[model samples]
Target: MFIKSFRPFAQSLRAPAAIILVATLAGCSTFSGFFGGSAKKPQPAELQPVVALVPARQVWSARIGEVTFPLQGNISGETLVVASNDGTVAALDTRTGRDRWRTSIGAPIAAGVGSDGKVAAVVTRANEVVALDNGREIWRQKLAAQAFTSPFVAGGRVFVLAADRSVNAFDGQTGKKLWAQQRPSEPLVLRQGGVMLAVGDTLVVGLAGRLTGLNPLNGSIRWEAPIASPRGVNDVERLVDLVGHVGRNGNTVCARAFQANIGCVDAQRGALLWTKPANAAQGVDSDERYVFGAEADGRVLALRRADGEPVWSTDLLRYRSLTSPLVVGRSIAIGDSAGLIHLLSREDGSPLNRLTTDGTSIAASPLLAGSTLIAVTRAGGVYGFAPE
Candidate 1:
């Protein structure tokens, strides 16, 4: 009776093995790419909410330097060094617009790179890198050709490059020659890493959209890796400012780039482990865990120290070439081009507090000094903003 009435059902499960096998197959249904079409409905895109900018605060205003070619802000010594296409380098007080000293670089200045440690480089149209001390000429070396890159000082070594493809390393204080080398001409023009970085025993050069490692001792090529920097842009001739000692890890030496890029290279081998484009690029300031690149597009990008990855980004362009972004007391504090100061969240781009500079364009980057926001403007303005 059971076999006749439930004949079909009994046959379907002829064996306990077959019953379990069918059940297993049913349980293996996939959510996508076959078995089952999809699970939940697709999520709809959401529009960003309109954000209201907090009011800007004003501090002080003064005309410190004149806008010569847009990207040339080569100020040095207590006097601000302002260069014009007219072959003049003006020295103004760092605090006041008052003139301190001025000299003719002998030719139309192509690059306005200088140092504050009691020296300034005066370049002629012919590519002469001269060492000047306290407004006086110390030593001048006629280069093989003209140079567009700035000078770098580190490990008691001051380095300058000539358009002729020569690299010269000299003693920072005495203006004596340490070593020199020539780079082979490549199809794509090569460039040095940045003027801002002066590490212990290494001098980094950015070339052919790559970072070249050089032994400061012998000026020899130590290693090479591709690190693309902004080549040519109106008002922005360069986008690489080779920043500081990227907390070294093992054989890898980490450093920040002016544009939204950073990398950790084998200090000895010069191999690239990882690279990520930062959302913003301007002046990068950082701590142990992150490196910050300031962007003209009005955003602050934070990258991880281990790998060049974006952790967070904050937009502050509305205020002006906002102050240099700083990592302080768990917050990123910066001043803006409009003379407004701000305290932003370090974890994510969020508004924290505010500071004001009555000055204008504080156009330069902020001095992220140990919880202090110091900035200057072309009008010879200075400010000291701190936490209460």
Candidate 2:
């Protein structure tokens, strides 16, 4: 379900004829399989053993609303901010999962619900950035083009990636344009989950399976490292894009590219630490010792964060498209297309627990709040679970 979201973005660009045909093939469910596409609706794994590595229970579950377009929920300090495509944004308490505030801005939200404790912002489908101050609309500014990624809020500035392959920065307080930076883009790009992470004073952006560190103050390129380069002759075989979440632990940042590889880099010096030939549909997450990722074939892998060596892997849920892994307590939690959340032991990758939410595939990755795990499904079901 998540991989299918990239089709619209590729369609917006003036791609080559071959690339356009492949993108259209990706959109058609029947034709996708002949091209070796893994985006099909796969059957979930049979009932597996629950090891009880950590006792957990669902704290609360609620039907927030419908999200016509896929968008990930954001985790603030004590609030969980989520938005629907129809422009309904809500802030929920982390512990109790109670609604703090929610309001409709009367516009179709295309980009985000990005917040920095005080202010929250979202991009409308009409190419406008809307800022909200404590649930009240503050200001709206027009953008150069439509944005599919989330608004990145940091250091009194809001950063977004437009459909034209440009990054625009605006003042968080007043919606004034700060600086805009453009990069050489492919004819096709992923429409969703292209993230920008703020590391100290620098900004790390994932563009076309390459990592570039930009000076947020002036939008200048500091360093570049390629996660995967264009290789195949046709554009479809060469469609390596940085997808899913980009995570950081201490000074190292890690990201995953579709049909490419997963790699970690030093956020300070932009040094490539390690790159592994892993074809994963989603990104990777880590604790202190190990990094965890979910593959398109329903295999979960664990690698040493220090050296990027394989630690363990499990294929207990093969063929079920899984969400990115989220580590909570001693278990690695991942949601599947069947709406089941599987918790595995962090030590040996053993099945710990399983959860279900609304019987719909989870579009957004799970968010960790304190010790609890908050996940939202495609059907707009929000669930909060914690150790018992």
Candidate 3:
């Protein structure tokens, strides 16, 4: 027997009986009765011995409140900005891990930590977008719907992609609305973070399974490239939201459609390069040569950047919930649910070294700043590592 669990977007809203029934049937599957009673989850693959090929050591550590939502660590120059679910947000020096600034939003945050050095932005659970400057609250404006994706702050403006499939931009200094672009609503949306970033003068975002580019000056569509089209007979199977932490080399951007496909796009031309079947829910990272991501079963894979072809795949971490991969130097770093950071060779998927954090799930994808590698745990443990 097999059982699959699907997380709802918002837990506060209660659906009627009919809607609940339909959602349950669409989101989950079980064959317990057909078997005997229940089925056990597959055991995680045994970890290989670490060889310490990469000489890295934890340099500094810090903390905030425990992170409960999708948190994207924003990097600007030498500073890395992070936020916790309890409304605590802080800026730290990537070199020394010393606090540059620390402040709270005065309300619980749902998603955030987008910064462009001068301005920091976060979306609160109260449906408000909050902007901060040097640890002080500058302005906040109410949003129309919930946003699970971190706000993208750039070009003196803040852009938000909401769960309702709407994109809005606001003045970073005044909280005044600039423009809003709404898309056709879907029956179901993922609770996870979606892709939103800036490439040159274009604003690239993920709406459903399509990578969309818009003019940042005003809410106007520039191009829409499909990574995957919604298929299947039910809403859950048709849910194809693009996840975050995309791979970009110049104008070429690659992303993962939730459990559907992995593909790259030429953002400047608004053209898709290629897409290949990939059953993964996490996003991908890239170097100049390869795109890297972890499958739902915890297999780490690297595909060619020019064309979507598998270069290497490793199942040593299978069944262990893994975060998106981060390409650091010649190695790839990934955090697991057991709070361990695994480093593998970029040439081949071989174990290089392993590091540990407070025994909890990695709250977000690992980030790199200058020469330091940052990983945050669900228990609010922030660790900075550097080459020894």
Best by lDDT: 3
Considering every candidate listed, which one attains the maximal TM-score? 3
Instruction: Report clash pairs, candidate 2.
Output: none
Give me candidate 2's TM-score against the actual structure.
Answer: 0.88
Give all TM-scores, in the order shown.
0.60, 0.88, 0.90
Which segments of model 3 are wrong by more than 4 Å?
1-37
Worst 10 residues of 3 by lDDT: 8-17
The pairs that clash in candidate 3 are: none
1 against 2, candidate with superior TM-score: 2
For model 3, residues 1-388, the per-residue Cα lDDT tens digits are 0001111010000000011111112334422211244678778888878899998999999998988778888878888898898899999988888899999888999888777788999999988999999999999999877788898887778889987889999988998999999998675676678888877778888998999999887879999999999999976667778888788888899899988899999988999999999987788888899999999889999999999999999999998888888888999998888899999999998999999999898888888888899898888888999999
Off by over 4 Å in 2: 1-42
The C-alpha stretches of model 1 lying farther than 4 A from their native spots are 1-63, 69-109, 122-126, 155-157, 162-166, 171-178, 184-196, 228-261, 266-271, 278-283, 316-329, 333-342, 353-363, 368-372, 378-388
Worst 10 residues of 2 by lDDT: 8-17
lDDT, candidate 1, equals 0.49
> Quick one: ranking by TM-score, best first?
3, 2, 1
Distance (Å) between predicted and true CA of 211, model 3? Answer: 0.5
